[model samples]
Structures are given as structure tokens and as C-alpha cells.
Target chain A: MLKVENLHAGYGGAEVLNGVNLEVKAGTVVALIGANGAGKTTTMRAISGMVRPSKGRVLVEDLPVEGLAASRIARLGLAHSPEGRKVFGPLSVEDNLLLGAYRHLPHFLGFRSKAAADLKKVYDLFPRLEERREQLSGTLSGGEQQMLAIGRALMAQPKVVLLDEPSMGLAPVIVQEVFSIIRRLKEAGITLLLVEQFAKSALEVADYAYVMERGKIAVAGTPEELRKDERVLAAYLG
Target chain B: MDTSVIIQIVVSGAFMGLVYALVAYGFQLTFATSKTINFGQGELVMLSAFFSLTLTRLGAPYWLMVPGGLLFGALLGLFVERAAVRLALEQKSEGWILLTIILGLLGFSSAENIWGRDDHPFPTPISSDPIHVVGVDITPLEISVAVGVLGIMGLIELFKRRTLLGKAFEAVSADRDAAELMGISSTRTVMLSYALSGAVAALAGILVAPITTVGPTMASALILKAFSVAVVAGLESGFGVVVVGLFLGGLENLASLYLGSGWREAPGLLLLILALALRPNGIFGKASIRKV
Candidate 1:
């Protein structure tokens, strides 16, 4: 459902993602695992149009999305949950989620009940946010904010969602909880592309795996194939 | 001093405060959107008032002239945003204070050339009839000032809460990147903020013209006090600004009457200092995140 072909993207004078190619089928998780500054976040940003690719194509359902604004890319059903859980700090939890659903705003504005039902669905996915519906999002815990971030992107009703370091700054237990939620999302048929530094945890859930090093994709394989690969074990598993 | 004197001073203060709140609201709008202000806001007011006076002389009715003059203010705001504010953001200019002040001076000088540096007569739409309050007389203009500010505040609240563009604006104000991620055009929202601010400032100038008289540089001191109001109330809280507006107006008037007219503005400013000392975030403002 999504494809990135020979993509090249960078900031300032330095190129961070060079000649990268990847694809994700519907209803599966594709994990890109790498070290810090491995161009994982840069790749996610390029795909979402937060940073445009200098060369190459990004396609969702075979429709080219290069050169679009981040918000416009979001409208094409590709949502991004940023690396730092960048929730709109002063806004209420509910508004933050509604921000995720920007493409759906016109649909909701005409029918209050529809918006309410959507909110109820998000509440079911993460009950804590419902309890803190009126509380400012910045006051949320690391785990809660991560959940809120994912919930916000889900609010967009996107066909593909990008997850960037959902585990960073989160406790091990919270990380497990967030990953479990990702598991639930996969079971519910939401396509996901995740970038993470935690190899073991990411490998367990990732259907396909790609290891990146210095802005280049060094290896790509099925999860089982990568699990047995010697380099994958010696370099990343340790 | 009789109770009558107190009431009359309050009536005057309230009237001036209406214009004060209007001017302060413009400052608040610009800051809330771009985390910047047009210190030239004063020029917008002075120029708008001068334009109204010019129109009145040419036979335009007060109401007809008011909107026309305000459109000029709005245009002025748009121009500043396009040429100055946008340039600052593009170049990542750190000296917003200096740039805004320079713009203010430019605007002031432009109006100075037109108005010839003199005060001119500008009347109000409201009748000049005076109403008695406990044996003290107050004019309808004063009443209109209070009522007008309140009315605009209500309208603004409704617009922000109910409209799609308003909601988009709120989103942008809270988080620029996230708003962009949501498909909101940050450029449009920022320009809208300036437009709203300038329009309100024009309203303030036209409203106060009958009492203060129109002049090229009249809004300089007024804008300073309005900036003080924005500081004391905090730009994030629109409601807090109105409360601060009313309080400062009353305090300024009371101080002038009881202490001395030269020290009239001192009380409001002193109160601002006190509020900032107690709550640096602002009396009703929220504490935003500070990057280390």
C-alpha cells in the first residue's frame, strides 16, 4: 500500500537518506532498525513530507506524494507520530486527537454525534486520555503522551502510520505497553512503518526488517530471515 | 471630594479603557499567532483616526468613514506582515524587539507626513447626550466604549470557538508544526492574526478620536500602555487581558484623580510590575514550555 523508491533526502548541505527503497503491504508492520543518526527519523520525515526527498518517489496506493506539504501528505492517509511525542502541549488531549483528524474535520463539523463516536473509539483504544480529556496534553506522562500521539495519528484515519522512537524516554514497562498497543493495531489491520533502536522488541513484532547504517540500508529481509542473520545478531542484538 | 467626582472619573477611565482593551487585544492577537507584535500598532491607530478625520471633512458620515478607515489599518497590517514580519521569520531574525520598533517609527513618520503633526477633530457615532449617575453626568460615548469592547470580545470568543478557520488559528497558535502537519497554512493564519489586530486597533482609534482628538503620533503612548496590559495579563489568555484592561483603566483614572494627573499612568504600570513580580507568567497566563 506504500512505496519509497530510490529516495534521497537530507538537511542543509549533508544528505542523510541516500538511495533508499522500501515498501509495506496492507495489514502488516515494517520495522526499520538502526543506531542513532541512522537516518531512520529522516526517512520517516521524508515519507511524510516533513522533509522533502531531493530525488525519488513516495507513493501510497501508487499515487505520488513527493513535494507535498506535511499536512497535505497527511491528507493522503499517511500519518506521522513524531520521535519526541510532540503533542500540542497547551491543547487539551481531545483537541490534540482532533488535530490528528484534520482531514476528517469537515465530516465531523456537520455531525456532532459522529465526532462523539470517533472520540469514543479513541477512548476505547486508550482510556486514560478519556479520563484526562480536559487536561492539557503536556501534563501527561511519557507513556500517556506516546499513547496520545499514536491516538492522534489514528484520529486521522490514515491507511499507513509512521512510528518514530515511540519507546524513547519511556520506561521499559511503558515501552512494552505501547508496543502491545501497536500489536493490537496490527491485529486490527492498520499498516505501520516503525523505526526503533530496540532491536529485540522491534524484531518480535516486525513482519519485515531493514537495518540502516549511515543513511544507507545495509540489509533487508523477512523477520525470521533477519533473526538468524549473523551480522544482525552481532551488530544489533548485542 | 464628592462621590460624584469619583463616579465621573470612573466613567472617563472606563471609556478610555475601552480603547485600551481594543488596542491591547490587537497586540495580544499578533503575539499569540507569531510570538511577535507590531510595535507599529500605535501608528495603525493614529493613522486610522487621521483617515476618519479626513473623511469626515470630505462629507462622509461617521459610520461610513469608520469601516473605510479600518480597512486601511487592516491593509497596513497585511503589508507589515508581508514585508517585515515575514522577512524576519524567513531570515530567522532574533531582534524582533528592534525590528518591531523600527516598523512602528516608519508607520509613525508616514502618518506624520499626512496629518502634519497636529491634533484634529474626530467625532463619535454615539450621541453626545449625558446621563446622570448619582448626580454625576456621563456621556454615551463612554458607555459605547465599554459596550463596544465587550461586544468585540464576545464576537471574538464565538469566532474562535465555532468557526473552522478560527479553530485552525488556535491550532497554529498552540503548535505551528503540528498545525502545519494538519494541513493548516501557517502563512494564512499569521496574516489573519495581523488583520484582526489591525482592524481592532482601527476600531480603538476611531472610538477614542472624539475625546482624545486625532493626531499623527497619538497612539505612541497608548500603544505602550497596551503593551503593558499584554504583559500583565499574558498574551495567551484573551479573557485575562480584558480583566487587566478594566483594572488598569480604573487604576490609572483613580491614581490621576487622587494622586496627580502626571502620575496617572504610573499606578497601572506599577500594578503591572507587581503582577509580573508575583506571577511572571502573567496574572491569568499559563506557563509555557521553556527549552533548556
Candidate 2:
């Protein structure tokens, strides 16, 4: 389980996440849907230890990870597949997947072979990646790049996976494909925290959803509950 | 002017440019990894040269100096990464670019005090005897430089391809936030890049020392030339940098002979300006586009 309580975060002096509360229960998919700058990304950053909360606590399996470095937090099995598909352009598609298992290298700790096996599993998930395994990632099409991004994250074998705007800039068909992958992850019993601007699509797949506005949560519920809510429909589902 | 003299200047200028590309390649490494520029790079070269000279002067076999220079260079590189690069990362300021420049100034000036800043002839390990290639007299020094820089390029390629750490460097450079999510340590990657930068600078320093001079200001021209080369090459393409480095080098030499020596800096700088104006991304650099 992951918990963020009373979280406060910002860039420079402008607060982006204020007293925000959220959680992803084990084996559940929680989609955080919001307007632009509604603190969805900021909230994810805080949870993944990318940004330190000015005030709050982040508990990973009840372990304090609020102010820890991201790598440290990642060891606790929380991995974020960031917005904008930040795959290494010059490296091969295969190498990009390998990098997602970086913490396993240099000490093995029985993780090297495990990471290798997990990487092969990622290749299975995205066979196009395996076909273009030797090609430089930078040259991949946007849809392929998004697939590569999710594939790379899965290589980490994370306990809780965070996706920020995976559907951004991708084609409608590709977006549907990516959301299908998210849906599949939930089917596989993985805990997921997804932040998306495409609220309607996100809530459709989200088991539990939160609608954020101006750096705070406006509403929260199960997918069915939020789907029927008038405010959620008017403000976010549109 | 005689044809041979013009040819000599042109050939030498081009060869010198290859050396400049070698130095600039160092800058490209750090810039790619962390987006932090190490202004002290020139001093790193100069210091390496002095290390080589001191070792040779101490009667250490010339063969020992190669690895000796590289080892010493690597240490200096590790030091710079820790002391200078770390400061910039901690402050979250690219402003530490000035810190590296200051480090270079302090380093170069202190070296001047220690080594007296006098022009000292360096013994070239390879033959200085001229060999004619295409009716042009080229020394073993130029050939060695061409080989040395090319070797460095090959090695860096291998590092990025074959090594686990090199991929880590690439991961960090591609997207630091995403890299962290993958559990990649940014500090380690940046340190690795800087160390490689220092070594590259040292490689350039050691090779150019014999051709130019072993002095406190030994690498100043080399550093400036590298800056120009990197600017023209778009600061991204490593091999592209080497090609541009050689081209500008040759162009400068040709310009100096046909027009005047004063026009030497003019062409390289002009090329840099023209490149930026036409393709701000650089001759070899690809533009980065944000998804959102």
C-alpha cells in the first residue's frame, strides 16, 4: 500500500500540491484525473520522491519515504514512468529496458538475473520493442516510444507503478492501446497510480478516481460512482 | 607566398583542428550528461601535459607516460567532478559554469607559477619526420594526433555501447527524472561523464603538448578552438564534432594562408555563427521536443 498524507509541494515558490491526500491500495488501480496544473503531476512527483513535500508524509508499505532520494524510494518498489517518454535516444531499445533495472547492477544482490528475466517479460509485453531491440530509441515512433516507456518501467518490477500523461501526444488509437496496457496491468493485480488529463478515458479504466482542481482534490470515488456524479461529469468527464 | 608554405599552413591548420575536436569532445560528454559545462577543461589538458613532462623529465620511460598521463588525468577528472560539478548540482544552478571557469583560472594561473609558464619543448613519442601525403609534408605528430583523437572516439563509443555504466550515463542524460524512477543514480552518472571529460581533455592535452608547447597557457588556444568546434557541431554529435573540428582547422589554415593569419579565428567563429543561425540545433545535434 502507498499513502500520501497532508502533502504540500511546489516548484520555486508556487505550491502545486496543497494538503493533498491519496492512496493506492495493494492490487488496485487508482487514477488521478485533473485539469491542467491541478497538481496531478506534482502529486505524483511527491509520491515518487522527485519533489520533497514542504509538509507531509509518504508511506510506502508504511515505511517513511517522504524526503528520501528517488532511487532510495524506488528500492522500496515504487517506480514512475514519467510524462514525455524519457527514453535514452542514443541507446538501443533493449538498452533502454536494461536501464530500468539499474539499481540491480554492481551488487547483483540476486537481482541481475531477475532483472534480465523481467526485461524479457517486457519484450513479451511489447513485441514491437523486441523486433526493434537494436534500433536507437530516439528514432522510434511516438506510439512505439510510449510503449518503450511503459516497457522500461515494467523492467523495474515495481510494486506500485505511476504513469504521468502516458496518453499525451500519442494518436487516439495508440492512446487506446496504451490505456489497454494499463487495464492489463490492473488485471495482472499490479497497484497503479495514473495521472491523466484525459479524465473520461482515465476514469473509465480507474477502479478508484480522484478529480483535482487548483492543487487540491475536488472529488473522489469508485469509477462507477464518479461516472454518475454530476460535478465530476460536468467538470472532469467532459 | 610559395605554394608549399601555403600547403604547409593549410595542412597543419587542419591537423590542429582535429586536436581541437578532441578537446571539444570532452565538453560534449559533460554537457550531454548533466547539461553542466566544465570551463576548467583546458586547464585539465594543461595539467596532464605537465604530468607527462614531469614524468618524462624524471627519466620514466616514454612508454610509461601514456598510461601515466591517462591515470593522472582520470584522477584530476574525478576531483573536478566532485569539487566543481557537485557544487553546481547542489545549488541547482548552471551558474556553477562560472565556478568551473574560476577553477580553470585558478588552476592555470597556479600551474603558471609552478611550471614558470615558459615555453618548454616537449618530446614527441612518435617521429617528427615529415611524410608526404598527397604532396603535403605531414609529421608523425599530426598523424599521432589524428590517431589519438580517433582512438578516444572509438573508446567512448565502446563505453556507451558495451559497458553497463555507459548506458547508465545515457539513461541519466536522456531524462534524469525517468532515470531516477528506474533507480539510476544521477550523481554517479554525472561523475562518470565528468571523469571521462577530464580524461578526454587530458588526452587532448598530452597529444597537443608536443605539437604546441608545454606551458601554463599551453591549452588555451586548444580550449578556445574546442569551444568553437563544439558550438559548430551542435554540442551533441561526438563524431560530428571531430569532423567539424578538422574542417574548421583546415579552413582556418587555408584562410590564414590566402587572406592573413588575422582571418584564422574569423572563419571558425564565422562558421559557428552561421551554423547557429541556420540550424540552432547544431550540425550534428538533434532538437529535443517535449511531448506536452
Candidate 3:
């Protein structure tokens, strides 16, 4: 559903993503695992148009989307739950989810009724969100915020979702809860490109995995194949 | 001192203060979305008033002239954003400060060239005759200023709180990147704000033009006081500006009455310096904690 061909992107003159290539086919979870500064997040950003690629192509459903504005890319059915759960701090939780479906809903009135079905599905996935729908999102705890972030992304009903670090800065128990949510999503057949620090958890949920190092994909295989690779086991699994 | 005299002074000054609040609200509007305000807002006020006067002189009815002036103001605002703010913002440069100021200077010269430098009396259907309330005489023109200021502010606040597009506006203000991810364009939001701000500047010009007269230099003093209100109230709070604007207005009038007309501008300056020294974030502004 999404493909990146030799994408090169960076801040200023310093290139962070150099000749990186990957793909996420429809209805499968693709995990991107890498050590710090391996360009995993930048890869996701490049694909989502958050960072403009200096060179190469990003295709969404075979349409070239590289160098497009981020909002334009989103309107074309790509939802990126950016790093650090950057929810609108002052807005109500329900408003955050409604904005996820911004492209589909009406701009002024009756948006609530329009977004009812999507809101219901998201609430069913994370019941806690329903309980705190009216609360300011910034007041939510870390795990709750992560759930809000994921739930917000799902609200888009996008064809592809790029989830960056769903487990970052969470307690161990909360991390487990997040992964279980991911498992549920995979079972529900959502196409996702996940960038995660926890390789073991990511591999377990991923249909396919790409291990990145120094701005390039070092290995690519099925999760089972990645688990058996001695180098993958030594570097990531260890 | 007679208590009624004090009330009369406060009542008049408070109404004038509402004009400052209105212009300050204009600054708050653009600042909310783009973190940048038009330095030439005073010029915007003067030009819009001048435009409205021309509309009146062209034999347009007062009601017709108001919307015409507002439209002209919104277009001028869009011009300012496109010509000044957008490029600087895209480059992540602070050049907009200088650019907007230059544009304001351009506006000032244009107004002088087109309308001449002399102050002109702005005709209004609203009466200037004072009606006695308790022992204080209140002018219909002053009452109109309060109604206009509060009425527009109320409508905007309602729009922000109720509409989906308005929610998107707040979303951009809260986090530009996240809003962009949701397909809400920050550039457009900034444009809307500037347009609203320009409309607001026009409204202020129209509402106060009768009382202060329309001239190139009329907005200079008004803009200074508006700047003081925005600084003291914090750019984030709509209600804060009204309260602070009223307070500053009253204080300055009292200063002029007791300490002489030379002290008229002193209270606003003092309050501004005090707000800067003691509460840099403003009394209503929440301290921003930058998370690394």
C-alpha cells in the first residue's frame, strides 16, 4: 500500500535518511526497528511528508506523494501518529479524535453526528477513552495519552497508519497494554508501519520486519525469519 | 471629591478603553495562530477608518459603509500576511517584524497621500448627546463603542468554541504539526486569523472614529494604549484584554484629571513596564514549560 524508494531527507544540510527503501503492503503490520539515530522515525516522517525528502520517491497506492505538504498527504488517506504523542494539550479528548477525521467530516456543524460511527469503534477499542472523552487530553496519564494517540490515528479511518513509538516512556505494564492493543489492530486487519524501540514486542506483532542501521535497511524478512537471524538476535533481541 | 465626578470620569474612560481592548484583540487573533502580530496594526486602523470615511463621502449609507470598510480591511490583512508574514514564516525568520512595520509605514504614507493629513469628523447615526444615568452623563456614542467591542468579541468566542472549523483553528494554535497531520492547514488558519484581525481593526476604526476623528495620526495614541493592554493582559486571553483595557483607560483618565493632561499617557506606560517586569508572561498567561 505504501512504498519508499531510496528516500533521502534531512534537516538543513545534514542528511539523516540516505538511500533507505521499504514497503508496507495492504492489511499487514510492518515493524521498523533500529537503534538510536538509525533514521527509523525520519523514514516514517519522509513517507508521511512531515519531512520533505531531498531525493527519491514515496508512493501511496502507487501515487507519487513525495514533496507534498503533510496535510495534503494526510488528506490522501495517510494518518501519522507522530512521535511523543503530540495531542492538542488544551483540547478535549473527543475533539482530538474528531480532528483525526478532519478530512472526511463537515468543517462547521453536525460533525459529532457525522463522526459517530468512527468514534464508537474507537471507544470500543479503548473504553477508557469514552470515560474521559470530555477531559483535556494533556491531563491524561502517559498510558492513556498513548491510547489517545492511537485512538486518534484510528479515528481517521485511513488506508495506512504510521505509528512511531507507541511504547516510548511508558511503565512496563502500560507497555504490555499498548502491544496488546497493537495485536488487536493487527487482528482487525489494519495496515500499519510501526517504528518501535522494543524489538521483541514489535517482532511478535509484525507480519514482516525491517532492521535498520546507519540510515539503511540492514535486513528484511518475515518476523519468523528475523527471529532466527543470528545477527538480529544478537543486536536487537539481546 | 464628589463620588459622582469620579464615576463620570471612570465611565467615559472605560468606554474609550474598550477601543483599546478591540485593537488588542486584533493582535491576539493573529498571534494565536502564527505567533506573530502585525506591527503596522495602527496603520491598518487608520487606513480602514479612512476607507470607511471615503465610503461615507461617496454617499453610501452608514450601514452599507460598515461592511464595505470591513471587507476592505480583511483584504488588506490578507495582503499583509501574503506580502509580509508568509515568506518570513516559511523561512523560519523573524523578518516579519521589520516587514510588517515597513508595510505599516507604506500604509501611513498612502493614507496621507490619498486622504490628506488633516483630521476629519467621522459622521455617525449614533448620537453624541449625553443621557444622565444616576449623576453621570453617558453619551450614546460611547455606549455604541462598548456594544460593538463586546458584541464582536462574543461572536468570535462563540465561533471558536462551537464550530468544527473553529476547533481546527484552536488545534492549529495548540500544535501546528499535529494539526497539519490531521489535514488542517496552518497557513490557512494563519490567513483566517489575519483576516479576522483586519476586520477587527476596521471595526475599531469605525466604532471609535466618531469620538476620536479620522486622521493618519489618530491611531498612533490609540495603538500605543492597545499595545499596553495586549502586553498587560497577555495575548492569549480575550477576556483579559477587556478587563485590563478598562482598568488602564480609567486609570489614565484619573491621572489626567488629577495630575494634569501630561500624565494622561503615563498610566498605560507604567502598567506596561510593570507587567513586563513583574509578570512577563502576563497575569493571565500560563507559564510555558518547554519539554526537552
- Over the stretch A189-229, how does candidate 3's per-residue lDDT look in tens digits? 99999999999999999999999999999999999999899
Residue A4's lDDT within candidate 3 is 91
Is candidate 2 or 3 superior in lDDT? 3
TM-score of 1: 0.90
The digit string of per-residue lDDT tens for model 2 on B211-264 reads: 788999888767877888898888788888878887888888888777887887
lDDT of each: 0.83, 0.84, 0.94
Q: Rank by lDDT, descending?
A: 3, 2, 1
lDDT value for model 1: 0.83
* TM-score of every model versus the real structure: 0.90, 0.87, 0.99
Better of 1 and 2 by lDDT: 2
Fnat for each predicted structure, in order: 0.41, 0.66, 0.80
For each of the candidates, the C-alpha root-mean-square deviation to the true structure, in angstroms, is: 2.9, 3.5, 0.9
Predicted candidate 1 versus true structure: per-residue lDDT over A1-238, tens digit per residue:
9999999999977999988889999989999998889899999999888887999999998999988888788888888898887888877898787767777776224533446777788899999999999899989998999999999888878889999999999999998998899899888899999998888889889899899988888999998998789998889997
> What is the alpha-carbon lDDT of model 2 when measured against the actual structure?
0.84
Interface RMSD of each: 2.5, 3.0, 0.6
Docking class of 1: acceptable
lDDT: worst 10-residue window of model 1 chain B: B90-99
Displacement of the residue B255 alpha carbon in candidate 3, Å: 0.8
Please give the ranking of all candidate structures by DockQ, highest first, separated by commas. Answer: 3, 2, 1
The residue ranges of model 3 lying beyond 4 angstroms of the native Cα positions read none
